[model samples]
Target chain A: MNESWDEIGQLFKNARSIVILSHVRPDGDAYGSSLGLAWTLRALGKEVLVCNEDGMARSYRFLPGSEEVVSTPKTAPQGCDIVIAVDTSTQERLGPTFALWNRKVDINLDHHASNTCYGTWNLIDPLAPASALVCYKLLQALGWTCPKEAASCFYVGLLTDTNAFRFCPLSPDVFRMAAELVEQGADPLSLSEGAYRNYSIGQFHLLREILAQTVFAWENRVAYYRLTPALLKQTGAENTEVENFLTYLQKVSTVQVAFMLEELEPNLTRVSLRSRAPIDVCQIAQRFGGGGHPRASGIRARIPMAEMEKLLLEEIRQVLQ
Target chain B: MNESWDEIGQLFKNARSIVILSHVRPDGDAYGSSLGLAWTLRALGKEVLVCNEDGMARSYRFLPGSEEVVSTPKTAPQGCDIVIAVDTSTQERLGPTFALWNRKVDINLDHHASNTCYGTWNLIDPLAPASALVCYKLLQALGWTCPKEAASCFYVGLLTDTNAFRFCPLSPDVFRMAAELVEQGADPLSLSEGAYRNYSIGQFHLLREILAQTVFAWENRVAYYRLTPALLKQTGAENTEVENFLTYLQKVSTVQVAFMLEELEPNLTRVSLRSRAPIDVCQIAQRFGGGGHPRASGIRARIPMAEMEKLLLEEIRQVLQ
Candidate 1:
């Protein structure tokens, strides 16, 4: 069950030392929510430690207090008065660090609809655009002001989670929150540069190859790209670098369904699907034993890349028809 | 001299039938500001006609009142009480449409710093970020409520003029205005999709070729791409499609100065320059008889493509040093 804001405030006030955790393979929302809370708590004279399983990425190192986010300790730090997990949908998402913490989660703050109530107290609003936004509203409710550093972190979370405000269901409050954050000294341009325009030369090369091989079918309503091991090797880009390659296909005005097929092995392919129209890609992914949001989903197939592509296309064609 | 909001309101109030004009090769700011103003005036029971020399692009045709925007007529329409220019920086930029209007511009509303103030009553705010914002403020000051359609148009202008809020000097008012517009029924997601994600598949192909030929100089501080006639031919893309090719190079995190050299003819190469760092690209463009803002500028060189590239590289290297 979710706890009231007053109860959460009391918990924070009583705690002298706090530990913040987010999901493994942290994104901006994970780092932003965790660091934002850490900075706010520190401003209130509380000792806060922020931890992530994989630590921080090189691109996001520019964020203030990013240096302070340490790798999840082998054992929980002594005298941790409260354990707060933010942006983690479930306890398992906290990775190996979850096993190290002997105490129950004091609070679980998140915005994911799939978030399990895995804490003694939970403050989850699935309607909130970003977990950082959920954290911001919590601070507002607690009558605590966000520090400039905290504002910057939260702003990154908001910006990245919304894909620079391109995603759907953006409320007026979203813009209002953005305005408040900017007023609180969040540098939108610098933050946007750090979060988005920091792509490496190698990543650009990989994008080039992907764009060149882009294929369109079903009267150009469907677009797809394939990334093979040879392509990755030639571009000197890691598999992770191609995560956003689907954006190029999405940019096509006629495309309703766009996807990427990554050849993980000779007979192993990873397929990512995105829908711009009224299509439930998650349903299709679920058929292949994968799951995600309706608009975006993924599936890992044991079949060869060509076979998987054919199967996915036929499935998509039926849906389109 | 610029006119006060009250004076501008009086002009709008006295007019019965008005013609709104924007610059040629109209971008979102041009289309958005003109249509936004047109919708506001029409809501007040005034007759409004929107005109652009180039008419509306297919991408922006989705905007409300876009269908009403006519190409510059052979001559001005009869019974037009006033001629108002929305986003035109100079009378010349109004293109051949300027000559067709027998009367002088009654009001010139713009946000460009380089605005020539070519109208009898000009309202220009260099720091407003978008001309649509300037127009929005005028409507606000006049105590006129923006129609939902007007709000939608203004939102597009704000989104595109600021490059989706990634540009510099974004004041708190920008986000606040965005919130107000959204509250007034502007659809951010659809508006953004219309403005940004409507690229053609051919454009993507051109971008791929540009990315493949991307060159890094000065230890990666300078990145550039050449759009040769051959590449365009092979991709089956028009020259105009490559206008934003510099954006790909701008995405390179290490790049300080990024540029694109398009071979217009055998000896004529058009170069566009963009600076991420504090390096002034305008000065470099000026030396080659070209001009634009400090961060973004362009030049048309009569020299061959390779020679022009060499000259620009030397110029940028000196500035980078």
Candidate 2:
């Protein structure tokens, strides 16, 4: 990785115009590292362009340079000399129809252990908590001062990828980096509000309805909630708002497996699953032709909500056994 | 504060036995700093007896040395030559039966700006995020190595007092201290679970019920929820479980003020209030003879729930106006 980083640094040094790319449906870390690195490169007199298939998460709009992210890159910059992908594990994940004039990836900076090392130069550390941390270190190695704006972006990256610092992989180095960033003028409270606290009233209403109607099975070890069109209409919430609803269900201490069943259509239900230790939810999602990390996963099923719930419960029970 | 700290250090050096006391109904900082200081003192071969009017919060039972806290101290410990009060602004807040055999308070360490400086030697910094930070600095000033146990205690203090680092008091120093503590063996994941993640299944049920029945008024800016006795009875939730219910209410972006009205008696209701900036909830609670911080407060009213809601709404409206 050190040798690869040295090569990546050489690529960065040689590039006069660069485009930073991240995976589609970009998260805070995606935007954070891309924009953060873009700003750092720009500070060093390099022309930088940041592109993502999905512009930015709405909650993260307050982050610096978030508005400048190009969602659709129809024409690459005429003088574009390098393409650096960040927080992207796979090339296809960078989004369909995304290409820099058919140019190969010059540099890849990521934290996924499964990285394929497809780039000409790869600086990947799967053990890193977030790619933004890697970006900060790269900036230091490149001899660039981390501006407050870039620091805020990195802070958001760290805060969100760690689920507001509650997730695992929050090493001492991460905390120290956070402190240094904050000292450089990253407002943690405001960044926290932007990343985690900025929820619409409709989401709360929907959450409440779902929580009240939750069903517990297997001695309360399997908890699941259902959200139908009616509930969505009543609360005025969009489908995106349901992304984190399972977290509340997972909060139930006895719930080894928690899930949310959302009625995308009369016969189509979108299932989001979460599990604690001793249960692997991703496997269940994979069984249904979907996949994600071990603890969290999702799948869309062509079954009724009740039947799907029963099936999921049985599957989860088997996994527990 | 430095001169006072120096005197405080001298007292620590002179005393062979010390008893650390915090305010009644001790919080995480109280337990953390007391235990943290106690461990450091013990390592230095000084006898330390940590006492609290109320023992550690049940969630903090995972903290090392928490079991040694003497909740019902019939008398001060034998040979106790120094009494260091921590996280307590006033001496009376230490509890009704607390005293050092009629001796003067040898030292007072706190973070509250309103500290009365009631000790012979006072080291109070209202700007400090938590008393535990003060304790860490004191340990450094006294040249004591912070063992892993002490570090874990301090981490809990920092995590809880900052409300898991989302609160406004999280300065750069707090993060640095957290990093140092983690380096000394403080497990962030375990500490987080101990402080915020451990919730009973019944609490979730009760929370669900509250959210479903929430009442929104003032353009959904003033959202309040009611918790009836029947609901609590049905869910088997203790009254103390409702302490953090207002957090959900506060999550709504449009909600400028949020409160929970719980029935404490047939015609008596306890109202817990929370608000964002530009509104001082403490002032609102004061109108009903309750006092607390600007963001959170509470009051008990001897009126029916509906009438109390109306009255509180009017008061809040007037404040908004």
Candidate 3:
């Protein structure tokens, strides 16, 4: 990782115009790292562009330089010499922009253990909580001062990736870095408000619909909720609003695993699982040809919600027993 | 405040046996300040007794030395040279134990702006985010090294009072202090889990019932939910679990005020108000003969739930217009 960091720093030093891209459907971490690195490069008098095939989410527009984000496959300046991929583990995760780059990835900075090492130089630390932390370290090693704008972007990324530090893997170094970011002018409270507090009216209605249908089994140790297409239509809630629905069950002290089933179509179901106990939901997801972090995982099943729920519950019951 | 700090420090320096007390029905800040100060005094070779009239909550039993907390008015050792109130603002908030202290309070440490100054020397800084911060400052002023145990106690108080640092009132200094505590061996993730992730099964059922009947008014600017005896009984939820129910509404993007009405008896309604906008729910609560902070307040009415809802809606409409 240190060798890759030095190599990436050398590449940045050698390039004048650089383009930075993150994964499609970018979350706060993706936006934060891309924008933060973009701002840092701009500060060094380099021409820079940040791109994603799927544009920034409305929730993340509060980021300082989000307005500068360009849609993917945009033509870069003639002199663009370096391309950096951030927060993307696999090449395909770059969406159409992966083919648009046409050149080898000069630098790949990510925190996912699954990173494909598609770059000429890769700096990946799976232990790091967020890619924004990697970006901050890179800037520090390169002797760049993180101004207020860059700090805000990085802070937001860290906040979102850690679920505002409620995730168990957060180390003390994360908090120390957070303190440094605050010194660099990241207002944590305001960033938190923008990232977590902003919720659409439709989201509340959607929550009501989902909660009303919540079911518990296995002595309340296994709780599950489903969001049907009809409920979505009635509440006018977009799919993204359900991203955090699993948390409502994850907090139950007695619940070992919580399942969220979203009906993507009449007969297809997308299931998200969250486990708070020693149980590994990732293993369960893998059985369904899906995977994620140990505590959170997902899969898509080509079956009705009823059948899918039964299969998932039986799997959990087997695991618990 | 500085003058009182010096006097308080001198008293600590001269004392052999000290009894530390916080408000009745102690919250995290109350437990944090009292326990932190107790540990600090113990480090100074002083015999310390931590007491609260209503005892520590089950949630805070994780704090080190929590078992040592004496639900008061317990007898202090003979030669207990000083009486210290760590987080209590008024003598009454100290509970019946206040009358047990025959001598005047030698030191009163608090963060409330309305501290009654019932002590011979009072160290109160309303600007401080939590009483634990004040206690940490006090220990620092007196040149004390906070061991791992003491740091954990203080960290819990800061974490709980600031709602895990999501509150807008938290400043950069709080993060810095949090960093120092982590360095002293306080684990932020575990502290957070102990304080937030440990929710009862009944709480989720209670949330479901409440969300199913959430009411929105005034163009969705005001949202309210009521917990009746029947619903609570059905969900098997205790009254204490509903303390944070209003937060369910506070996160709504357009909500100005969120009201939580709980029927304590057939005709007695206890109303808790939370506001996110410029409207002062405290003022509204005051008109109902109850009061609290600007963002959160509460009151009780002898009228039925339907009549109370009418009165509240009318009051909120008046404020909005």
Which candidate number maximizes lDDT? Answer: 1
lDDT of 1 by residue, A1-321 (tens): 376877788888999999999987688889989999999999999999998888777667868899999998988899999999998877877988667766688899998877788999988898888999999999999999899999999999998888788846789999999999999989998998888778777787788778778899999989998888898889887565466777778888888899999898899988989887478898899888766667777788798999999999999998983
TM-score winner between candidates 1 and 2: 1
| lDDT at residue B306 of model 3 (Cα atoms) | 84
Better of 1 and 3 by lDDT: 1
lDDT of model 1 at position B208:
75
Tens digits of lDDT, candidate 1, B159-218: 888878884668788999999999999998889888778877777777777787888999
lDDT of 3 by residue, B1-321 (tens): 744556667777888998888886578889988998888789889998888887767667778899999887645557888888887777877887566755677788898876789988888888887899998988888888897889989988888777677745656677778878888888776677677766776677788878878899999889999888898889887666476777778777778889988888889999989886467888999898877677777787798888899999999899973
* Cα lDDT of model 3 by residue, A89-125, tens digit: 8777788755765677778899987788998888888
- Candidate 1 residue runs with Cα over 4 Å from true position: A100-103, A228-230, A263-269, A300-307, B100-103, B228-230, B238-241, B265-268, B301-304
- In the predicted model 1, the residue pairs found to clash are none
DockQ computed for model 3 against the true two-chain complex using alpha carbons: 0.59
| Interface RMSD, in order shown | 1.2, 1.5, 1.8
- What would you estimate as the lDDT of candidate 2? 0.80
Each candidate: RMSD: 2.3, 3.3, 3.1
TM-score of each: 0.94, 0.89, 0.90
Order of candidate numbers by lDDT, starting with the best: 1, 3, 2
Per-prediction DockQ scores?
0.77, 0.64, 0.59
